[model samples]
Structures are given as structure tokens and as C-alpha cells.
Target: MTAITADAIAFRAARDHLLTHRGDPAKVGASFRWPRLTQFNWALDHFDRLAREDGDAPALWIVNEGAGEQKISYARMAARSNQVANWLRGLGVRRGDRMLLMLGNEVALWETMLAAFKLGAVVIPASALLTPADLRDRIERGHVRHVVAGEAHAPKFESVAGDYTRIVVGAAQPGWTAFDASRAGSDAFTPDGPTQATDPLLLYFTSGTTSKPKLVLHTHQSYPVGHLSTMFWIGLKPGDIHMNISSPGWAKHAWSCFFAPWNAGACIFMHNVARFAAPSLLETMARCQVNTLCAPPTVWRMLIQEDLAAWRGKLALREVIGAGEPLNPEIIEQVKTSWGLTLRDGYGQTETTAIIGNAPGLPVKPGSMGLPMPGYRIALLDAEGREADEGEVCLKLDDVPGEAPGGHPGTGRPLGLMAGYEDSPERTAEVMHGGYYRTGDVAQRDAQGYYTFVGRADDVFKASDYRISPFELESALIEHAAVVEVAVVPSPDPVRLAVPKAFIILTQGSAADRTMALDVLAFARQALAPYKRVRRIEFVTELPKTISGKIRRVELRQLEISRRERGTRDAGEYFEEDFPDLKS
Candidate 1:
């Protein structure tokens, strides 16, 4: 198929179809088709056309910290991006060149991204939170040919050596070119060549939660087209203002904050801040008329700490969703009660877009991560690879026999799936075996097909011949007023072979002393099953987390193993010999 057909196949015209059916999976899946084209560029095709026709319409709305807000029209954005594309092309940026975009959620960030897409350049978006070491890894591993960053961040890359072209967005440096100069260039964007649907568009060096970060490669169609499910999941409507609480350079950032919302012709709202302040975010949301909102569980957790009812914005806001981590049912309920809004939960990864999500109008099953999106055939596979009611979540590519409807057909396979990790074919093969992509997460499905997340494949352990899910135990523990955040890991025990242990982070008013620990322990005993009781307890000040805000259970597991090896014992560790007060 030609590149235009590929582009058309990628964007499958699901907006109208999805809206008509609205969360009706059977109809949506049957109707959805990836947008197919012979020669197409989103920036040149969709973005520019939207700008030309809807020039007065607001495309981006950014609120700076307490100072003021700036709104840019779709027309301005189209022209600006075209100028940047032309300027970058003049600076040796070619169709296949890789560039690192390290900047805040500024206008230029979006502009550069659109420009990069137009140029068919592979953009590796880097967060300002990344250290020099992280930058080094991305620079060396990503094969970046150009670097686009704010002037303030230039010093961060000062020591990192690369032959890539440097383009600064804010202020001009001695060696870097100012992004402002792009305005002098022509608004007419003339692509040197067509961008194939298989063309590499973006590279993401993921924030490694389990292992070293892998460079996640996305095709021109992967994210831009894949996020249609995300658009449906969030229930974003045309002319709506959507604000997603995500830091720049992350996959989730792009998921809700960019393509998904834009695909529906919604205004993308950004509230730039150094740290998360609950009241401030709410205030901004209200002030800016945010119609739909998406945030990770971390931000949602912090938001719940404050009185949620105190702030109600004037926006015709309808949808709110949570990702990043599993949404605690309690948090979801709290938000629902306070805001009269239900928090939808979605599950996906850096490798793909939102696959399973509680789409709008779907009856959310409390803690369940809703049904699979239309065009996705999600299956629970047992250890032997046969279908099961509860096991690993795997996609049945064979059953589909092809990509989902509206999925790339002659375009070859699914459009939403990744192009594989750059230079890591072995790892790619591991996950994409048996014509199925194993999610590595285990889950149980009900008769109705609603799936509930069990835990990471490695996080699940057995004790006393009873399989245990850490999430279940942790959920039960957090119900106690004293517990703020908790992690459950297996502690070696000679009696049961292994036992559940609680690593607790107490609430603000809760103490870390023995009294508080005992209180939490007692609460856990009452809340959890007898077999899954916390046999040991540790009061930790904070839990180790990946940059993405996921708790590093692997690190916690290592700590437990190290403690076992050192033979340094703690009070909560159950020991028959030491516990003279306990009767056998």
C-alpha cells in the first residue's frame, strides 16, 4: 500500500462511529477502521487543514504558573509547525534522522513535535526531570541526530557529547539555534518525501520500572493512530478542553494530552508546574474550563488528600480517567462522592496505546479495568497458553486473524501496535510469541468478560501453598486510617516456606512508632484473609519508585532478600523461638 493509504489506515475514521455508538463495544469494534492513505502527513494533512478551515479555533491552551494563560489558534499552530519543519529541514534534519525533544510543555514543544512528524524524523522526547546520565543513555542508545531543548536545560546537556544539531526553544545560546527563527521561514510546508505508515516517527527510552529502559520505537501510525482508543476511553468531545496531568516526555503524556484529544478536535490544556499542588491544579482546571481530565494514580492520590469538593470548575467537564497504576477503588469512590464524577481506569503500556479501558457510558465494575476496547481481542491465558478465566492477559491476534476492523489491513497487521524496540529484536520476540502479545500482567476475567488485574507476573508469590496477590493485600491494608501507602512482599519463613510482609508508609497523622505499626498490623489482620495476613511489618518513610511513579516492587523484593541474607532481624518478623509471649 502507498504511504497515503497507510496514513488513512492508521487514523481509522472512528470519531463519528465511536460517538454514535459511544461505549457500545460490539458496534464500535465492528465499525472502526484505521485511516488509510497513499501519501499523507498528519501535520500537513490533518493539522494544517484544521488550521486553515478552523483557524480561529483554539488548538492549545497553556496556563503558566499563576502568571497568565496563552491560547493559540489551530491556524497559528499549523503555520508555526510548518515554519519549524522548514527550519529543521534546513538544519540537516531528514526523514529518518532521530532528534531528542527535551523541553517543558511549552508551545514550542508541541510545535517541534508536529514539525518532527512532518519531517518524518524520529523524535525521542526527554523529560526535564532526566539527569545527565539519563540523557547520556538516550543520546548513545537512541542514535539521536539532533537535540531540541529549552535554553535553561542546555547546561544539563553541557557534558554530554554528541555530533547532533542543537536547537534551543527559549533563548539562543552560543552554539544552539533559537527556535524563534523558524517564524521567518515559509508557512508553506513542502515535504521532501512521503512518510510511510511503517516509517519510524518516535523513539521513547521508557522510564524503566522493571529493568533498564528500553528504547520504545513507534511508527508514524503507532501513536498518532493508536491513541484512537484513548480518545474513546477519555470520552473527549469536539470543542472540549482537555487537561491531562502528565509530565512531558512520557507516553501517558502523549496519550491523553496530545493526539487523543486532538483527534477529537478538543483543545489541549497544559498547566506547567514544578511540583504537584492539589488546590492549584483544581483551580487551574476550573479557571481554564477544562472539559475532560486525565491523571495518573499518583496525582489522583495526592488530589484525594485535599478536600475535593471545595473546588468546582465552570467547565462543562464530563470525563475523568486514571492510568499509570491501578486505581484504588477507595480513591475512585472518594472522587465520585466529592465531584459527582466516576474515575475511569485504563490499562496499557509504553509498547501500545490504551487497550483495555472503561469507555464512556460503560458501567465501571468498581476496581475492574473495564472491557477491552473495540478492535481488541483480549484473552486470559494460563501457564500452558490455553485460554483460561484468569491468568496472563494476552491478545488473540490469531482469533482476530488480522488487525481489528479499521485496523491496517493491506497496510499490514495492526496499526496501533509498536514497531518493536530499537535494536532489541530478542526482547520483542519474547513478548510477541505464539501470535500473541503477552502483557506480562496477570488478571482474572468474569463470565461477562470484565477483567481484574491480579498483579505483575513476578509480583505474585505463594505462601503456605496459597497463591497471594500483593495488590489485594495492599488494598486491604490501605483501608486502615493509619496506612497511607503500603507494599506487600513475600518474607521467607521456615514454617510456611514464605509469608506476607507489609512495608508501610503511614498517613500524615499516623506515627511510625511501634504503636502505629501494631495498629496497622491489627487492621491488616482484620481486613485480609487469614492465610494472607501480614506476618511481618516494616515502617518505611518512603517507597522507592520509578520516574513514572510506579512503586519499585523489585527493589523492595531485593531489600527483603538482602535482609534474609544478612540475618539482621526486625521486631515484626514472626519467629517462634523469639516470641515467648505466643503459645504454640
Candidate 2:
């Protein structure tokens, strides 16, 4: 056995402090401290130690319908990951090498992540849904040396044409190594040397909600240890079954699935289906006794479309959370009404862990994403870089004494922040400038410290003299019975300079004609203020979205601009002037 390291001790002390004072917010904020570690290997020090202690306790539970369920214990996970690490080492997977993991929600996905950590190899998470072009970009730009994916996704890489090592999970692919071979390898692994706390560990590609994706970098202590705040936010406890509905590639998947839940010694419950049927998923959670859940807003919206009352009281959820995007107040209210549990909203980005979230015992305001979590100092900076009630949400890095209100926070960076954008210092400097990490997303902090989300910096527009927020308008539009999904963009106007226009998806088997548009426009008019009312409505079969499910408003805006430039009108567009019935 190895002697207990200083890094492990510090990590444990910080985690224990949060657990102890999980109730008193003031006490936690005043006394809590971010751990300062010189050397750390989370896979070796934390996960392995817990595995040895927890023994047969469930660490990962995957629910599969016809294939039966797979329940892996902590001890088995440690052994399996150790075997994978040894096999990877034998195949020339060295420290600092980048390995892209593209697989479904399977045991091998978790196994490969732990193995990469043990081997000191940097991991780049990739969704299996990537196209051939995306794969080429990841391989060339990410500098991938190895790829671990399911055999089904192997064909997509055939045309990618890289000099990387190919390893398949299910079956032996043509000219690829089989991951099953690792089972016969040694189950005991050893590190070559000590790992620095700041060593690169993960490289994530942002979901590109408004623009092209950027590579986000994290270190050994950033995500795995930094998610203590996320653990604190979720109020995760030992023996709890946390079911987080996130895809494998995104950063949220690692935030909740790999680190936060495991840090609390809770079992990660994952459900896999060929097609997502929320009713069936609710039944699984009910039957298996899920203790907590964190799902994206889109999933929550879809779940509510069904008969939510049928499985209302049957759920075993103690904590329900909304993640990924800013959730509408309507969704939160509907869930609260049905399940008798407040669906709390959490705000964060790929650059950091839970910077601000609604921790337990905090007063949650409707349409607000709660307060700044422990270890985070939030400042809303306006266009002039001055603090404001509503502005770009920036994190205070250091505290400059005798300075102004928006002065630098401090010298040392928080443990939760990413190292920087990989190989893109210019882009890194842009966001990390002025002693603050600009989150790009904006919000408004109330007098009581509750923060309500505004639209993204690039998504907010102006109509007449008043500033317009697409999120606020869309939030109100979704409350209408005929609306399924909607995206608000600015339409060029000579009078108001611009007016709010909507690209809407109606309910299934519903009309998209003048009557449907007028009904939606009337409902929105009643809900929103005069200046904020949607002036034009256009029916669309589908809204353009990033693979992560965020609406591509930038594209929608450009489309409108081009249409006006070419002097062409969309046949689907319905203006308020044409619908005299909606004129009030």
C-alpha cells in the first residue's frame, strides 16, 4: 500500500468540511477553503482508495431493457480500470498523449476514462454521433494518438485517415485492437511517477451554442476535485443513487456522471434506450429507487408533454435539478406541481465546475439560478467593465485591496477553472482578460443575491429603444398550448431598427397556418409586455440546433439578414399587420 499523500489529505479535508456544514451557508462561505495541492492523481488517490474501502457497494448501475442490467461495484471498477490501464501502457499509451473516447453509455466508457487517468494520458471526450468531418477535426486538431470507440462507429473513422491507434469496444474491427482483450491483462496497476496537480487531464469541445466549438482544458485537480462544489450543489450523500441525464461527450456528463456522484460515494445510475421514451425511464427510476436526478431543460420539457401525473407520486427523487441551459420558470413550476419537489436550476459553463448553483437550504427564487456557490465570487460586468445588476457573469479570481468595486479578485486562480483553451492562447486571453473569466452568458443578480439568467451576450438584441432578451420572449412563448419549441431572432426594421421575430415549431398534428400563428401571437401578446411582444411568426418543421440541443440563433439571424438583402420574403412568415384579429 502507498503512504497517504498530502494531496489526498487536503482533498478529503475540503470535502469533509462541505459535508459537515452542508446546512449553514454563511458558515460554509466564511470558513470553506479551496485545497492547495502540489501533487495529486485523483484516479489513484481518491477513486482507488474508495473502491478498496467500499468493496461490493454499487458504483455504476446501467439499466438496459432486453439486455438485462449491468451493476458494477466499486472494487470491480477499480480492478477493471487497472486492467485497462495496464493494457494501454503495453500498447504505447504514454503520459501526455491524447486519447479520444467515442462510445455510447456503456461500462467501457467509464472504464476508459479511469484508465486514461491512471496512465496519465489526456482524454478528449467525443460523442458517437460525430460526422466524418468532425472526426477529422478532432484527430488533426486534438492531436489524438489513440481512439476508443464502439465497433458501430468504427466505419465513420475509415475515411478520417489518421495515424492514430484504433481500438474497438464490442467486436474486433478491421485493423483495430479489441478492448475485450484487456480483461485478460493484469488487474493491478502502478504509476510510473508522481502526477502534478496542474497536469492536463481533460480536453472538452464546447457545444457551440452561438459559434464554433472551442477546446476547453482542465487539469488533474480542476474537474475531479473541483466538482466538490457540484457535489455540494446536488446535496449528494453516501448510498444515494444519482441519475444524471446527460450524453457521454459533453462536460455535464463528467460533472455529474463521473466526478460529482462518485465523489459523494453515490452510485451513478444510467438508463440507455434505442429511442428515448420518458415514461419508460420514469418507470425504471421508480422501480429501481432513484434518489436524485439532474436532467437538461430540453429533456424536462419533453417529459412534461406526456401524462406527468401518472408517475408523479411514484418517483423516489429527493433532489431534482435542471442543467445544460437556463430552464424556463414554466418547466420548473410544472415539475414542482406534479412531483411536490422544486426543480432547482443550476448555472455553469465548460470552463469551470459549478460556479453558481442553488445549494440546499438556500432560498430559491422563481426564474433565478440561486446564489454563488462556495469558492466562487461572481461579478456582473457591463460593457464598460463596471459592476452592474445585469451584465456578463464574470468570476472574481483575486481580491485587490483598496481598489474599486470591480477590481481584480486576487492573484491565484480557483481550482475549478480550466487551465485555458488548448493551443489557443488568443482565445484564452480574450475571456480570461481583466482578472476575470468572462462566462459569455449574462444574468441579473437581485438585491437578495439570487441570480436570474438573461440571454447569451451574442443572442441579446434590441427592438426600438428597449433591449430585448430572446430567452425571456421564448420562455413566455413556450407557455402557449400550441407551441412545441420556438427560437426568437431579430428581424430588420426601419422604424424600431429591429423587431422580435419567432421561428416556431407547433405541437404535433397541429396547424401552421394563419389561424395557428394568430393564436400563438395572441397568447404571447397577453403574456408579454407591449415592446417585448413577438411581432412576426414563422412556422418551421424544425429549429436549427447544435447537436447538444441548443438553438442556433446566430444562424437563424443570418438567414433573416440574407432574406431581407435579397428582397425575398419567406412564404411561412406571418406578420402582426396581416393578422388584424391579434391587434389590440
The best candidate by TM-score is: 2
Candidate 2, run of 10 with poorest lDDT = 403-412
Please give the lDDT score at residue 117 for candidate 1: 93
Write candidate 1's Cα lDDT for 360-455 as tens digits: 888888779988876567878899999899899887555334555434421233457788878699998988888788878999888877888889
Which residue runs does candidate 2 get wrong by more than 4 Å?
23-27, 400-411
Clashes of 1: 18
Per-residue CA lDDT of candidate 2, range 423-535, in tens? 68999999998879999988998888888888899999999888898989998998887787889999998788889999998888898888888888888899999999899
- TM values, all candidates: 0.93, 0.96
- List the lowest-lDDT window of 10 residues for candidate 1: 575-584
lDDT of each: 0.80, 0.88
lDDT of prediction 2: 0.88
